[model samples]
Target: MFTTKDATTPHVGLLVDKVEDNVDYKKEDIKPLDKLTEVGFDIDPQTKNMMRGLIKLAEKHSVLIDPSAIFSPVHIAQEDIQESEAYGLF
Candidate 1:
């Protein structure tokens, strides 16, 4: 499982069969998921919200999960929601 946490959100993790190097890819390397490609995958609403797009890594096409999406299901107090220039990047 891979776990990630952000300053504004709780920690989130996902179970995986294996792990690989933390590499980067160019924007053009990613493709949007089509309906056919999404079939049979029972994605939770929260999980779906976390999906960014599809990207090709090596020879395999993979789902690119956004870090922000991991915390989509979390409920924050209204008072906890603060606006700051630091957060504008997200």
Candidate 2:
């Protein structure tokens, strides 16, 4: 997993699936959302500002999550809600 410090909060952390040597992406491939609500995230509008955008990879899709959002308690709580709602059986 990838780990990094949060820009907005000193005590919080930013974690991801994998950390690699930084890769480059085309400008056009990066799609921005006006708000986190576009992705069903129920976070504060302030936290929503941390969302960078989405990156298209072949036929798959990936999100460009901001370190600030990753470190946000509100964002984390919203994610937990989504995850549990999607897979309560686990």
Candidate 3:
């Protein structure tokens, strides 16, 4: 909704339905919405295994990944990208 309309972002040719721009001073000015996104997440036998792989990959680039909320993972991992492991059922 922001990219296609907001002049701050470039035109990415994304398809969006509608946008609301009413600044009515009501109960609240902004309404938060829960959005489900398809994201890549890894789960191993345990947290140790996960940390081992993370450490090994970090050693290659000599950088650590300490993620936090309010930031996108793509922004942090894009510089040192690695091919993801195959998806499977346990």
Candidate 4:
């Protein structure tokens, strides 16, 4: 979920689900998207448009969003890696 330096808006948003009634949520629970990339996540361009639409809808409803919660993590598929190397994009 990493973004280019000039990106004006995020291309994705995280949707965290809660399970435990007594669970405590902290800012630390949400890892920075850039850091996730170092750990093997990749930017999924296919989701960009969907995320933009969701964000726009949320804005229209006056929803307050945490900047840190805007990007979601996704694993980099082996196939994608091979493709990138093949095309010299990695």
Comparing 1 and 3 by lDDT, which wins? 1
Best prediction by lDDT: 1
Residues 25-70 of candidate 4 have per-residue lDDT tens digits of: 4443444444434757565654332232111122231112323223
lDDT of 1 by residue, 9-89 (tens): 544445565555565888988777554256665665555656778777788666776644343335552235444464321
lDDT-wise, the better of 3 and 4 is 4
Q: What TM-score would candidate 4 get against the native?
A: 0.24
**Colliding residue pairs in candidate 3:** none
> Which of the two candidates, 3 or 4, achieves a greater TM-score against the reference?
4
**Model 1: how far residue 27 lies from native, Å:** 0.8
State in Å the error of residue 70, model 2. 8.4
- Badly placed stretches (over 4 Å) of model 2 are 1-15, 65-90
- Candidates' TM-scores? 0.49, 0.40, 0.17, 0.24
lDDT of 4 at 65: 32
Relative to the true structure, candidate 1 has a C-alpha RMSD (angstroms) of: 6.4
What C-alpha lDDT values do all the predictions have?
Answer: 0.56, 0.54, 0.26, 0.35
Query: Could you tell which candidate, 1 or 4, scores higher by lDDT?
Result: 1
Provide C-alpha RMSD values for all models, in order. 6.4, 14.2, 19.8, 15.6
Instruction: Kindly list the per-residue Cα lDDT of model 2 for residues 1-88, writing each as its tens digit.
Output: 2234554435423345665446578989887764435768555555445557867768755567655444445545455433235333
